[model samples]
Every structure is written in structure tokens, then in C-alpha cells.
Target: MLVITVDLVPSGYEPMRRTIATMSISNISELAEVSDYQIEATETSNPLAGTPPRTVRCLIREHARAQSVWALVARASDEIMKADSAEL
Candidate 1:
């Protein structure tokens, strides 16, 4: 069976990594637990933006499975970081 795991860069934030719930690809509830999980993971594991709440808002504004959503979030964060850096 295929599994979906959160694959964000480790930020020495072990708690967030440990708390991530591994979901099965076949599970329809994958999106359910992703809201808080993603927020915490993004805030702790990979803080690409200055304000974590704002960053999370920009990244995940809709419901999606954790695996897929995280991928998009990572990409968005990278772009946001790049843009922020370019402004300097």
C-alpha cells in the first residue's frame, strides 16, 4: 500500500517531525489532519518566512492531502523566500 508522509526539510525541530501523522494514500482523511500538521510543520520544521502564520496562510489556503499539499507549500515557501531576498 502506498503511504503519504510529510517530507519537509528538517530544522532540528524533532517534535514537529515526530508529530507528523503518516497517512495512507488510500485514506480519504489525509486532508483532515493536514491543517494543523502542516502549520506546525511549516512553522517549526521549515520556517521559510518571517511570520509563520502569515506564511502558512499564503501557502495553504485550501484543503488538500498532506503529501501533495506539503510539496506545494514547500515550493511556495521557496518562491516567497526568493522574492523576499531579492527585495534586499
Candidate 2:
């Protein structure tokens, strides 16, 4: 199993929050085929920030040749903050 932590910055916000996720596959050999990933994030509490917390649900398609898990997460984060993407 792999545990991945992703740091996210919501649009129009200063404070940062994180999303943690666990995967069943561990190591490059385990990913011999394309895989689908879903990362769900709930609203976080930011006492210092006046705006409401952001919620996000990211869906990513990871190719078998993907180099690093971090790259996949970065794509997801970019998608999450898009104006028409998964942020709620």
C-alpha cells in the first residue's frame, strides 16, 4: 500500500490544506496498466481565514508509464482548482 499526501491551495485563498490518500498498489511493477484514481476531499476548518473551506473531488487517469506519484497528484490538484472542475 502507498500513502500519499497532497497539499492544496484553493482558488482565491492564502492558507493551504492537505489531502491524504492510500492506494492499493505499491511499487512501479504493480502498475503495469492504466489505472483510474479518485481523490475525495472534505471541507477543512480554517479558523484564521474568513472564507469558507473548500471541498474537492479529483479524478485522475494515471498511465502505466507514469514516473512519479507526485506528478499524478499535482495534476489532480490543478484539476481541483479549475473553474469548471471538481471543487465544491
Candidate 3:
């Protein structure tokens, strides 16, 4: 299986949730050719600084299936990050 890790920009609470949901849905559709697929979304915080980070991991049985959605997800994710960055 192949694992794709997507690092999401730290936006405020609501936006972060929305971004992950959108990414997960789009990834599932875009990688529908894969026989087996799963997504894990997580958020963690730095103990000292209290900074939070989010990650969305997509796991697929075939590397090709993973590759097919990488570009699309990456682009969309970048757009979200850019928008969030600007708000910072």
C-alpha cells in the first residue's frame, strides 16, 4: 500500500475542519480506481508553543492510484493554505 501525507495550513478551528473534510471527499472520489483506500485525519499541538498542526493521510493499495490524486489534492490544498496564509 501507499501512504500520502498532506500537511494542512493552520487556519482557525472552523476553516481547518472544512479543509480536511473537502480534501478527504475529493481524494476518495479522485482515487476511486483503487480497490482499497482509507484516510486518517489528525491534529496535534506543540506542547510548549501551543501551536497546532493538522495532517490528512491517504492510504491506497496501489501507487498509481495514489499518484492520480496527488496533484489534484496538492493543488487544492495549496490554495487553501495560501488563503489561510494571507489571513495570518
Candidate 4:
């Protein structure tokens, strides 16, 4: 899966990253139980003054599933992190 970060100015990428970091399943799980958990944020860009420059917007999609989407995403993240850490 691929996720893109969008920002008006070039420096906005850090803030965007912070937002995603805060939304991590482990962080939210500390508060409430996130179930059915389908949340996807897509960044789309369209040319404004032509193809040279473009404007971007984030498209968020949230849906319900029989199983907890958060579970799957969280597990995947943990597994990936552990594998990477071991390699380090």
C-alpha cells in the first residue's frame, strides 16, 4: 500500500508526517477501541497554473467492515517495525 503526503508549501510535509504519526493505531488504541477501522487518506494533485505547479488535497475515506480494520493495520505495522529493527 502507498500513501502520499500533501502540503501547500514544501515545509508542510513535516506537519503532515506528524499528523499521520499521531494517528498510528498504537497511539489511538491507548484511548478508545477503533473498530471496523477503515480509514484511508489519499493525497491528490491537480495543476493550477499549468503542469509546472499543482495544488493538492487529501481525500479521506472511512468505511465499516465486519472485522476490525485497525487490528490488521496495527499488526502489520508491528511486524514490519520488528523486522526492520532486527535488521538494524
Q: Which of the numbered candidates is closest to the native, going by highest lDDT? A: 2
TM-score of 2: 0.46
lDDT of each: 0.38, 0.50, 0.44, 0.32
* lDDT value for model 4: 0.32
Please identify which of the two predictions, 2 or 3, would achieve the higher TM-score against the true structure. 2
How far out, in Å, is residue 52 in model 3? 2.3
Q: What would the TM-score be for candidate 1 when compared with the true structure?
A: 0.22
Q: Which stretches of candidate 2 lie over 4 Å from their true place?
A: 1-32, 43-50, 83-88
Give per-residue lDDT, candidate 1, residue 20: 27
lDDT of 1: 0.38
- Per-candidate TM equals 0.22, 0.46, 0.27, 0.24
Q: Residue 81 error for model 2, in Å?
A: 1.0
Q: Per-residue lDDT for 12 in model 2?
A: 35
Query: lDDT tens string, model 2, 16-88?
Result: 5454322222333345567665555444444666435565655666545445866665665565655242323
Per residue, candidate 1 scores C-alpha lDDT tens digits across 9-87 of: 3597665555322333222334465432222122223245444322222223443444674565465455444432211
Model 4 residue 28 lDDT? 23
Off by over 4 Å in 4: 1-66, 85-88
Compose the digit string of candidate 3's lDDT tens values, residues 27-66.
4445465544444444455457664665554443332444
The candidate that wins on TM-score is 2
Backbone clashes in model 4, listed as residue pairs: none
- Over the stretch 14-83, how does candidate 4's per-residue lDDT look in tens digits? 5544321212222222223332222232223234623222222222223222447554555544443333
